[model samples]
Target: MAVTLQDKLVVALSSRALFDFEEENQLFEEAGSQSYVQLQLTRLTQPAQPGVAFPLVQKLLRFNADGQHRVEVVILSRNDPVSGLRVFHSAQENHLQIERGVFTQGRTPFKYLRPLGAKLFLSVNESDVRQALEAGFPAARVFPDSIKSAEANPDEIRIAFDGDAVLFADDSERVFKERGLNAFQSHEAQYAQTPLPPGPFVPLLQAIHLLQTLPANQVPVRIRTALVTARSAPAHERAIRTLMSWQITIDEAMFLGGLEKGPFLQEFEPDFFFDDQTRHCESAKYAGPTGHVVHGVANPR
Candidate 1:
């Protein structure tokens, strides 16, 4: 079928999905120029076996259009026999177009490393994803049918973000930073009891929310959101209350308390991760694509 701009897409494949290089590359290069881009590449010492829950790749391939445009898969791997074999099998079995190429070569045991070959990986973390979307790549992660039905159209692109610095003003962070943790916590506690001010990304969130609420026939754009943050337990109460006050419904929420975001994010398989802090963003980038260091209000865009 002929490809359409509406059908155009960019996706990242996990190391586990790759099976072969030569075959997969041929398919992708032939699929369409400028239609596919590889975000990360790494060589694996051991090839990924099928039926092992290659969640990242599975998420990318789940959405299918009117067959007008086929999903292209980019397998970023180093020169490893096992990795190549894995990519080969994934493409054939899943009907995915694959692109295989060497991203980095070294003796290090870590086959999959970040910032590989100059391409970027989108992280599932709310902050990381927020930065990536704002930076411009909205179609970073692909949503499967199951996830789509829960909200509305599974085929429509979905993007998520955190509250504070991401969707709203970094005022919360500022309060904590300048006033001290206790002061910040008290401020949040106060606002937690009442409605808080709107955030910087509020406009964008409203636009997306409108799209989701539109009738199926009239909804041309497909976008969804979730609020995943580190505000734990009682601290999270405020953020939740504010969201309710705004009448915005996040599809999913994770209030992890200073925990490693990689594993949980792996489940969501977000297209990108955005955060002001490099610590969380660094880990998230490895698991998925990530965008770093959003310029805050002080910097002034």
Candidate 2:
């Protein structure tokens, strides 16, 4: 029988998002691919530091122990095939159980998400992230320099997501962006009984929810999720009702009302946080690992 990833929690991420390739990336930017490849070859034995999503990926893979493979992480990168040797070498050095990869050599890698059945894509390139989201995948642009989550809890995995344009469709966000806050609130108020449409990250949330429902003895690690959004009060009602409709219950929810999310996120200390706007991503990174969803009307062409 052919191998399949349909049952796995598939995540495809770029080399930059998985490990710190900033120095090599800068080289590729200034001196071109040849120089970058040569440098990588020379330093193939040196393990690259973990990137922003490192903690999250590391913690998630922990679920695969005890003869179970619940998670699958792949390297979907634009690096040339020759340069990819280093990526695999680094993974090996770090003991990351990643065996699959797609090196596009220069092309957009988002095209392969369909074949992989990937539920999430994380890349350092904004364009790739936008392309993936446009292709209907839950994708995010990771900040390579963002502070990785402190490993305070080894037996649990914590994740957080922005509400609109993330776990829920950007309907309210579109209204807010085009008609201002008052109209956005009123629109949500008028339709408080109606659940917001599903967004790209819903599948991810559902997957996590499934893991949470498993008996504690069945899984080695605990999973906790939170809804961190800018919506508050009347607008917050629609977001809550939407989750209620889906029958998914998260551990926590925050409606900051245009306030900085960084401080609040710090208290939660998620291994990773995903948002759809640059402003929030910037602030959230300081608290923990952060990624930009790059979706909805907020990221219009």
Q: Rate the local accuracy (lDDT) of all candidates.
A: 0.48, 0.89
Q: Once model 2 is optimally superposed onto the true structure by TM-score, how far is the C-alpha of residue 171 displaced, in angstroms? A: 1.3
TM-score versus the correct structure, for each prediction: 0.47, 0.97
Clashes of each: 32, 0
Using TM-score, give the best candidate's number: 2
Show the colliding residue pairs in model 2. none
Tens-place lDDT per residue, model 2, 1-301, is 9999988899999999999999999999999988999998898788898888778888888888867888999999999887788889988988899999999988999999999999899999899999888888989989877887546678888899999999988878889888999999999999999998999998788778877888899888999888999898988988888999999998899999999999999998888899988999999888888899988888877
Per-residue CA lDDT of candidate 1, range 83-192, in tens? 34545654556655455444332222122323222122322223333444354332122111111112323454545565566655677778866887678777787777
Model 1 residue 133 lDDT score: 39
lDDT (0-100) at residue 68 of candidate 2?
89
The local lDDT score (0 to 100) that residue 100 gets in candidate 2 is 96
